[model samples]
Target: MTRGYIEGLLSSFPKLMIEGQQHTTVETDAVRYVYQPLFEDMYAVLITTKNSNIVQDMDTLQLVANAIPEICQFGSQDDIVENALQLLSVFDEIVSLGHRENIDMAKLKAIIAMDSHEEKIQDIIEKNKEKEAKLELKRKAKMFEMQRKNAAKAGITGAFPSTGGIGSMGDAFGSKNSSNFAEPEQSTYNNEYSPKPTTSAPATRGMQLGRKTKGAEMLTSLNDQVVHVSTDEHISVVVNRDGGLENMEIKGDLSLIISEDDKNATSIRIACLQDDSIQYKTHPNIDKNQFNESGILTLKNQTRTFPLNQPVGVLKWRFVGQSEDSIPLSINCWPSATGDGSCEVNIEYELNSVHMTLQNVIISIPVESGAQPVVGDIDGSYDFNRSTNTLDWQISVIDRNHKTGSMDFVINTENLNSFFPVSVGFDSSTSYCQVQVLEAISENQSVEFSSSSKITPDQYYVI
Candidate 1:
């Protein structure tokens, strides 16, 4: 129909309807207008041809009237105008091509809700992926910053050293190997340089004869490209009340820490200064025959590879010294009680090794609770902590110049055994067992590598 005809028909609705009627119908020669009164002068209406089924039209109009209240609140003119598009959509679902559709209210409401469970799950997964990506970026940034700081502290300015194999001892002595692991020839130089003393004094701790080594620089520079060689020594020394060695035991191990990204399967050649007093043991997976004959550490199976990103203990050596002459540093403590409830303690440490230097030496002596030590003639600094009742003697560096030093302190205790069992801790750039890495052979070729050796007193005390 034209717009003017539809408007004229809508305008004629009031004149044709009775005042008390609940439903209204207007008939003309060609068509009929059927409508129901809504709230506040609004109506739900439908137009159809006069020849159409009046009963079905009336049913469709009743459905449309029922749906208008569900779609628009209050059924006011403003509410109907606000939900005009929604009402039209509902009307389309009710009637199709001028015919009523076979649909109920529950099915129509379900179609209008339009909810999907899978879409919500996909959105959550996408958000989580974005969060994980941000966390990974932060972790990498922190790692890079730490590496930069370590490189600067070690005075490493340029790029890392070339990953070329060592050619000669003289050429690659101090430049390539930043950690001062002795050369193969110099492995026995410690015994020749400083002989073991015959007196009841400590022997040489290790063979650190040169300047301090910067082993951290090599490890930091090579990062994941190089394997790490470490020697950890656990020493336990017990001295009697008369400053005599009661028992001494030393245990050490050589461990290899490989990186996950390093795929070069290598066999390490080593130069060991064999001592009759020490016993050696190899790992079960190692080739014992090859290690005994040529001092090469390799896997027993030729086809098997070393486990990546883990520390593997390849060799272990043990030494049991019953003499005080083998001790690196000797401590003598003498306590004299006064008539009062206090005593004066005299403690002295002598470094017997003339060739090696010890760093960060700390001697811990227990004192009575709430008692302050009056220190005198101390060679180094001392800190008295009353909470733990510990007097810590800190010696920064002990070399030839400051080898022999003494510390005297007075405390309120006549029991000398309270100050007994003084523990000592130190670090040296040397290993008790002078085993040096000669080279690392991979695929019948020498692979570039670095080595670090250190000696530390795990449990050295005098009781």
Candidate 2:
């Protein structure tokens, strides 16, 4: 009945219309007809019972007219089909279950947008907070810079040799720390270095360390070659016959400076990992109890004997494979900032299965001419401005197993070409893992090996 009445009224809408009228109503067959002009040739006809409000409904019709143009590019049926889903959503916001719900343009558009205003507001707030943190860090750095200039004028040498003031030092670095980022007392440094906050990312805003994900550069360098080697005393592994780990022996015997007791001494843990195969078998004595479910060998205290000063400490295990990689240490790098006449770099690394403490770890980064880099974020003991165009970083000792380290600093170079090779020269203390399987075991497997590492330049391109 309603549909029949609507069609009859719409058929005679042209005859009952008032001139120069945007909205009007007429009674036909004793049923009131309500409608308003949407376009020059199109109109929206609202069918209703006799009790429906007339004047108040014109307001609703006006809102519908206003909203249609914003949603439909052209006032035609084709435009409605092109944006059918959007049009339905907009229409639903104005009317629900064939009845009017809301007609206020502000609320209607907001509902149709489906955009979370709260989230957008939170993002703005976070950006402002990060900005303020960066500004505060700059302010402290400037204060230290001024003091260093004054000290230089007084002919002071080696005053505050390192950035000793306002330093972040603790086990909870990058884990937990003071958030307020309180100001520290003034101090002079021979260099322009500021101490990192003892807690979190307050100091390294706009610059971050660590890999969120691996890229082509990291993948290309992981195979066939990894760490750079400068000295002897590297670990060598031999795969026994029948595809079992036959022996793992340290080639060089050297004095180990152990800082902890016998119970807490560093011990190398070896896991057999292959690329093509997952179910590689191990020797019976291979510690399945400490074995990792991820198919990697677990080097534990009870499984095998890793003794100090025993240059040829052997472990009998083998698997059928031409290659095995136990990457002891891996570095991840990405460009953090492209500054005015500068480009900042952030570095992160993982020390995998490394059992012993690193006595002296020096990271060498090649720098170009007129490009000076200042290292920070991990007691950045560095010597730059070398004639060889290299930046030498002396980092602190890494003690904990599965340890990780990070640093953020900048090099003064334009955006054209900046990132260069970043390699570490740690005291190849005691032993480092080098895996290669041999079907026929022999003395020829014994070889002194070294690695040459580089960070590809594409990883640092900010654009």
Candidate 3:
């Protein structure tokens, strides 16, 4: 009968503990079963002795609850203990109120076992909380170690755990320390020879180091090679490759240091009035139309020819392909010339700023005239000189209107590369200008004076 009663209660409370309300009176003939031998015998003794001390009996019941396996199916011994204690607590109140007919000793003991059942539950909760706390501490410790390693990699010295508290975990990763990681300081990596900034550009290092993009320098060099409005003919310069030539051609990058004063000057110009050849690539034998397919194929030969330098202006060359497209492949010829070693007839004159008058100052004369002078249209000059010379000289003016007698000459080691020396003096009485000429004489070449100043004192004579 006791086993039957226990089974019936177990069926109602599928879970170990039954948290519910039951009303009305009930009676049963109970049969007991012993899954735990000692606790089951203690419980049966309490039931047989109708006047058992309920608190002492409830304590024994709780011991039974604790002995039950944690993974036991729902409504096992522990749950039974909890629910029985609760029901007995209510039954004691009922018996005290004189409604004791439904009271049973086993049920009363089960109800009083609530304290022990709850104590066991509290122990389990506490254990899980302790484990979680330990895991959290481990996580925090690993994060701190990572931060220290990162700081060391960044070369920061004396870094220790912060008493002020940790910063953001995200910052401790690769982000905040990235800039300092394995990087030299700006002051250190920079060129030590770089000139300090001043009003003028730095003579040694004109541009800042590390400021140029990866491919910018190469692009800029190619851009500079593009021709834009050639004003004068090409000039001669040293044609040596910096690192010797190979494969009948030069490779590797080279730069020509041009003076700021001559940056605007034309790269090419006529060397003399005598007909000199504009160099070109020519092959006497090989023509493009009849390639190697023709029998007895003769390779082309190259020669230089003189072309008339009529257009007194500059021309630029933009490189395309250097070879013929079809099978008769021949390499293109490039001009290996520079203006660095060339010379120019740089003319300088001092004029009276106040007078604003025109004076025909003789710039050059006949040195011997095997080579005639070539002149472009005289670009107007600022500030004119008031001349006092009474002696007039004949000036050779080219008639550009007829398009004849016009001459252009380039300055070189062989030609008028040497500048004509000019001397200027003032006459106080007439406010006239007096001029003397300086001549360039080679050991073999002879020079002569052909023109003189045209300005006299009549114009600027103040009454």
Task: Tell me, by lDDT, which candidate is best.
Answer: 1
Cα lDDT for residue 4, model 1? 100
- The order of the candidates by TM-score, greatest first, is 1, 2, 3
Rank list by lDDT: 1, 2, 3
Query: What lDDT would candidate 1 get against the real structure?
Result: 0.65
Candidate 2 per-residue C-alpha lDDT over 436-460 given as tens digits, one digit per residue, 9 for 90 to 100:
2211111223222222212111011
Indicate the worst ten consecutive residues by lDDT in candidate 3: 250-259
lDDT of each: 0.65, 0.44, 0.26
- Candidate 2: which stretches are off by over 4 Å? 1-325, 336-339, 415-417, 433-463
Tell me the tens digit of each residue's lDDT in model 3 across 1-463.
5799656665533232222212111222442221112222222112323343332233233233322322122434675576665545454533443222322222333344332322332333233334444565567668777777888899875785443444454454333235423222322212321223234321222455768732243223323432111111111111111221111110111011111121212121111111122121213322323322321111232231111111111111111212122101011111121375323232222232222232332222111112222333333322211111011111232122211111123322232311211112112211111112232122223222121122221111000
Error (Å) of candidate 2 at residue 137 is 74
lDDT of 1 by residue, 254-289 (tens): 876554334435788888768788888888777899
lDDT of 2 at 217: 30
Clashes per model (N, Cα, C within 3 A): 2, 12, 31
Q: Which stretch of 10 consecutive residues in model 1 shows the poorest summed lDDT?
A: 181-190
On lDDT, the stronger of 1 and 3 is 1
Query: What stretches of model 1 exceed 4 Å from their correct place?
Result: 1-224, 260-263, 338-341, 353-356
